[model samples]
Target: MSEKRRNRRIKNRNINQSEKSTISKRSKIIWIGIIVISVLLFSSLLSLQFLEHFIIVD
Candidate 1:
């Protein structure tokens, strides 16, 4: 691989995961937004699967 790719691989390999889960103050809002969107998406899928009534046009 090229030097850039090798450096990226090394950097990724050296990731300090101890602090990865600790969300920053600013990122907390973004995390909440992400969670809300994920929940909405999951609920929409569930509604489509089991709740929403659809008419089949044959």
Candidate 2:
């Protein structure tokens, strides 16, 4: 019985570790996506503003 319990505990630990790694990877991906999107939006906004300024000057 004790051996079975030990085996179950080891399995649970392995599962938990795997889950944590996946979770970390997912979070990293999400953060990278957010950063990329935000940067693109910021660049677009700046370009628009520059274009508007040029039009006004002309």
Candidate 3:
């Protein structure tokens, strides 16, 4: 009975550790995706402004 309890506790600990790692990884990926999307949006806006200026000059 004690051995079984020890095994169960170990299994639970491993599962918790795995869950924490995956959560951290998922958050990191989400942050990276947000940063990339914001950068792309900013660059596109800048390009649009430049295009407008060129059109006005022509």
Per-structure clash totals for the candidates: 0, 0, 0
Candidate lDDT values, in order: 0.75, 1.00, 1.00
Model 1, stretches more than 4 Å misplaced? 1-23, 52-58
With candidate 3 superimposed using the best TM-score fit, by how many Å does residue 31's alpha carbon deviate from the native?
1.1
* 1-58: candidate 1 lDDT, tens digit per residue: 6999999987886674435645465589898999999999999998886644553331
Q: What tens digits encode model 3's per-residue C-alpha lDDT throughout 1-58?
A: 9999999999999999999999999999999999999999999999999999999999
Error at 53, model 2, angstroms: 0.9
Scored by TM-score, the top model is: 2
RMSD of each: 12.0, 0.7, 1.3
Q: What's the lDDT for residue 3 in model 3?
A: 100
Better of 2 and 3 by TM-score: 2
What tens digits encode model 2's per-residue C-alpha lDDT throughout 1-58?
9999999999999999999999999999999999999999999999999999999999
Model 2 segments more than 4 A misplaced? none
Q: Identify the superior model by lDDT, candidate 1 or candidate 2.
A: 2
Extract clashing residue pairs from model 2: none
Task: Name model 3 segments beyond 4 Å from true.
Answer: none
